[model samples]
Target: MLQSPVEFFRTLPKKVCPECGEHIQEQAESYLFECERCLANKEE
Candidate 1:
């Protein structure tokens, strides 16, 4: 049985920070992507 694209993504792994190597939690309510690692690295 074939699943929908949305369903496929729901089962797929979530995005993570390439710098600190932390998971990037999704915040659909707000139109923003907050990356702790990237933010910290940017300050350096």
Candidate 2:
């Protein structure tokens, strides 16, 4: 029996990295996402 990748990822929970403060979605999205700290640094 084979497990579907979609099914596997769907079961995972979203996590936010304290160091970066970015929300990591269980499923990937099209748009690029960055942490607030990273974004602020980019403006500098």
Candidate 3:
């Protein structure tokens, strides 16, 4: 089954981090995603 780009995005779960409950930032042309703050904290 094939789906349009708009429909694909519409079906995606809310862009949010499971760690800190912050909204995840959108990354263009990327399949993996994470909240900016949580990612930064992980580097510390």
Candidate 4:
């Protein structure tokens, strides 16, 4: 189990949003691998 917040974050695969330069958390592949905001707009 994770021992702290820093350790938890260190385990995640985070990257900058290609469109907006915002930090994005990498989620599961089935979740679409996109910027949260961009993905929302794309669905609209």
Which numbered prediction scores highest in TM-score against the true structure?
A: 1
The local distance difference test score of each candidate is 0.72, 0.65, 0.77, 0.72
- lDDT per residue as tens, model 2, 1-44: 88899998778766664558678443455344655567678889
lDDT of candidate model 3 versus the reference: 0.77
Q: Which stretches of candidate 4 lie over 4 Å from their true place?
A: 1-14, 27-33
Model 1 agreement with the true structure over 1-44: per-residue lDDT tens digits: 99999999789887776666677887766442447668866889
Residues 1-44, model 3: lDDT tens digits: 89999999889987777787777667787554667777788899
Give model 4 RMSD, 1 decimal: 5.7
lDDT of 1 at 2: 98
CA lDDT, candidate 4, residue 30: 42
Whichever of 3 and 4 has more lDDT, that candidate is 3
Task: Sort the predicted structures by lDDT, highest score first.
Answer: 3, 1, 4, 2
TM agreement with the true structure for every prediction = 0.54, 0.34, 0.52, 0.46
